[model samples]
Target: MKTVLLLVTLGGLLVLSLVGGLFVWWGMGGVDISLHGMIALTLGCLLSLLLGGGLMFLVFYSSRKGHDDEHHRGPEI
Candidate 1:
């Protein structure tokens, strides 16, 4: 039952993403993109992915190593 539900959910998401992508592509038919623009867009996406993945990895790694433990603070005057 769980497997069937998971499969159905995934299938629905796949269909939705395909339809959304098609609509977006059709809507951008009038836009003219240069080679440099395409290169910049690709590099931006790659760098953003790398930065986000690095931050997430650091968070998970610190958490697993107990670096996120609470610290005792002295009373303020």
Candidate 2:
């Protein structure tokens, strides 16, 4: 059941992305990306993914290590 739902959702998103990209390409009317531009875009996407994943990892790590827990060592005097 869960697997079926996941597949359906992913399928819908894939279709939407393809359709949107097709429209964008048609609208651009053959505007081409230079090699440098393509490299920059790829690097930007990779950096964004790495930064987001690293931040999420730190959040989970801190939660598991109790760094985000409330302190109960008595209120400061």
Best by TM-score: 2
**What's the CA error at residue 76 for candidate 1, in Å?**
15
Q: What is the lDDT of candidate 1?
A: 0.90
lDDT of 1 by residue, 5-55 (tens): 999999999999999987997899898889999899889989999999999
Position 43, candidate 1: lDDT: 100
Indicate the residue-level lDDT of 17 in model 2.
96
| Model 2 stretches astray by more than 4 angstroms | 1-4, 7-11, 70-77
Candidate 2: lDDT over CA atoms? Answer: 0.91
C-alpha lDDT of all candidate models, in order:
0.90, 0.91
| Model 2 residue 61 CA deviation in Å | 0.8
Q: Poorest 10 consecutive residues of model 2 by lDDT?
A: 67-76
